[model samples]
Target chain A: MTPEPSPSAPTAAPPVPSTRPAATLQRRLFLVGSLLVAGLALSVVAFGDLGEDLVYFWDPSQMAAAGEDAVGATIRLGGVVKAGTVQWQPDANSLKFIVTDGKVEVPVEATGAPPQMFREGIGVVVEGTLTKSGVFTSDRLMVKHSNEYKAPEGEMSAEERKTLYTTVEEL
Target chain B: MNEVAEPVATGVITGGWSYIWAAYGVTWAALLLFLGRALLLSRAPDPEPE
Candidate 1:
């Protein structure tokens, strides 16, 4: 037989179920969704600026073909340095050279000590703007080295170097 | 345009490796911090029963 309840005892109500789990899950989902949206927005803005600033690499022939459209825009030009066309002024710290990709040649003027490996007949990438006059004013120059590492051949003839600074400067 | 535009000479960018390194460092630090925070939260103790 069950014991009888005391007259003085107070009745206790049933405990309410907790909603903490659902609230915690909702908070997590909100945080994750917000982060995703924010990241997407940030990348869109970053890429937009990058697309404008990042210049395209082009060879001498391609740059020539680009014509007036190539002027005033920053571009990275890649070509082999034409032999016998390098003019360096030590006092002025100015260097001039003609970059040729066989078919076409472009004159480049840069102000800085050439890198250790810089020389004639080597591939190089010059980063700068092409003026309306057609001279590439390079601020940064990078020499490209081949894996084979063969020594440079003899000097090119004066006839081969005939198409030099004069031709490109006229552009 | 009839008039030829003058080229804007940009200065040579030298010694820029420091900035590149700093950017990489900050990115890694942020990633690590986020991972640590997530792990800490996942291991946090549940609330005591009322």
Candidate 2:
């Protein structure tokens, strides 16, 4: 019968080998470990010393409530300069003012000349340590100006005119 | 006009480019290391069954 079957019919082709690489347990562990280490390194670099280096900004009222904890610690006190409390001593090169939050007032003795914009009733930020005698001894002072701008509504007072025209030494 | 001109910023920020380059260097180093690791892992042969 002509050797029966012709042996030409092909059986099911062998399954094609997968081409994509499979992730091994070791590789997965390495990936996880690399990510964990990177995250830890970034976190340590960013947040280390955050607490110790942070300088707290407090108003007079908040500072007063802090009591002894605030004493001798470097802090930034922000408040409006109390009117009639500004005393500039040109000979002494010292500026003494009282910062008030409308409820509490803190006396500040700052070394060096004040900024041109610094005046009574203006917002200011003083940075330094609080003395045990309840006075803030500041080495740096900054004037804070409001974002709102409007044209002058009235004539300038003599005092204001003098400040605008006079130099620090003349003041 | 006698009006005072609007105040303009006269100061220039100096020496910040080094920090930017340093940040890019770190990022690129990490990326290249990761890429090398991935390529090496992909080309490695799987162990034959014992």
lDDT of each: 0.79, 0.79
Residues A138-159, model 2: lDDT tens digits: 9999888889775455678778
- What is the C-alpha DockQ of each candidate? 0.07, 0.04
lDDT of 1 at B47: 49
Residues A1-171 of candidate 1: C-alpha lDDT, one tens digit per residue: 644334333365333234478877898999999999999999988876876456567999989998998899888999998876777766777888899999999999998877766777888899998998889999899888779844335576565556775687789
Candidate 1, superposed: residue stretches over 4 Å from native: A1-56, A149-171, B1-50
Interface RMSD of the predictions, in order shown?
14.7, 16.2
Per-residue lDDT over B1-50 for candidate 1, one digit per residue giving the tens place of the 0 to 100 score: 12212211222234678889999999999999999999999899854433
